[model samples]
Target: MHPRSLRHRMEKAAKLLVIIQKHTPEVDCLFAPEKGEQGHVVCEFSGSGMSRSNILQLGKDLEARGYQFTRKANPWLGQLSYTGKADEKPTIILSLPVVKDRVAINEDTPATPYSFKEA
Candidate 1:
């Protein structure tokens, strides 16, 4: 491995640490090598209160800091499981809802869509 590349990776890791520390204290952050991959660093964090907007903003922020973000999908429930990877390395796993549940209106309720036809 080239010394320059190693140094650059170290710098990135340091910067990521600082960013994580500054933005999220309640979240648990982990830095490790990607599974089945070599010469790559993966950052995984898990937290609550994660929404789609929040995740989008987070992605933008990470991208600005030289990290690529991808949102993961939920397998079982088919919902957003809140897991994303940055540069295929820095990954975020959130335990929050990306979409809200549908609210069912009562059948007896008068609230309904109205339609008018020209006479």
Candidate 2:
């Protein structure tokens, strides 16, 4: 069984997922595909270089909802944490699924590159 806190985190993640899906569009999905690791929020973005305006907009939207980013990788990848709770807690991580758009197709280009079951 998962810890209660983890459950809470996932619940929060679900809410964030709604927020991300509502905000992100496929066209602008360059830097981020459909989802990426984020606090309680699985998010998608435009690209590294303003490829999609949704990313910037999402930042603003997140701010409006009272979530301040904690850390990251490079300038555009890594982690996110809630405000005020920075001092406490061990660590918070958001696991977002890799976007299919970024995946490179092989010579055949199967419909689904990754499969849970091998036939």
Candidate 3:
């Protein structure tokens, strides 16, 4: 890789680390490779430790930090983007799992419009 690109990536990673520590210390974040115009950060919370409200709070916290959020195809997943003076804005892909046994689904329950498919 070019030296300039590597330096830019390092800078971005450093910035993200501080943001994550301050805004979302409860969740685990995996920094993904940059593609095209954006850097990707994948976040998933621990199964037993996380609640739906916690996930919702993360979204709110991110928004408060100046990131705009866009819901993904999955209800539990969404993308948050922040565009500053940086050449490539960071895009956080947050995936929160549905806690098992938390919601009881019955035959009378209506199916969701989204297809729950694996990526």
Candidate 4:
């Protein structure tokens, strides 16, 4: 790589994860989709040690810290199964959108729909 290009790459590499960490801590993170943007984030959390109330409170705390989240649910047509039983593990989906300078809702309407397909 050219010297300038190598430096630019290194600078970005050092900053990229710092930015993500600043925005998204272990509890949760938030971000918004732009026009013509599409992607997804899968977050794995440890709930094996905490009580039910502790887990729920952690979610609430993350929300208060400004993360937008929704419980992951079964697809409209059917639920996904592991082995023979349906996978009922709880998950949270986060999205960040802004209107003007303040944060706004990233809602889908009848005209525009959002869907996810997993393999």
In order, candidate lDDTs are 0.43, 0.36, 0.52, 0.31
TM-score for model 3? 0.57
| Alpha carbon RMSD to native, model 3 | 8.7
* Model 1 / residue 11 / CA error / Å: 4.0
Tell me the lDDT of model 2 at 96: 28
Q: How would you encode candidate 1's per-residue C-alpha lDDT over 78-107 as one tens digit per residue?
A: 244333445523344444333433443222
* Local error of candidate 4 at residue 36 (angstroms): 13
Off by over 4 Å in 2: 1-3, 25-51, 70-119
Q: Which ten residues in a row have the lowest lDDT in candidate 1?
A: 110-119
Residue lDDT tens for model 4, 51-89: 334434544544443444433222331222111101221
Q: What TM-score does each of the candidates earn?
A: 0.43, 0.40, 0.57, 0.27
Q: Which consecutive 10 residues in model 4 have the weakest lDDT in total?
A: 81-90
lDDT score at residue 108, model 4, on the 0-100 scale? 23
Tens digit of per-residue lDDT, candidate 2, span 1-119: 34765665556555555555565544222122212232222333323232335554554565566544443222122222122112211122222223344223332322222211211
Which candidate's lDDT is highest? Answer: 3
User: Which is superior by lDDT, 1 or 4?
Assistant: 1
What's the best-to-worst order under lDDT? 3, 1, 2, 4
lDDT of 3 by residue, 1-119 (tens): 67787667767766766766665677777765454444566676644366656556556555555565544333222322222223355666666553344233331333222211210
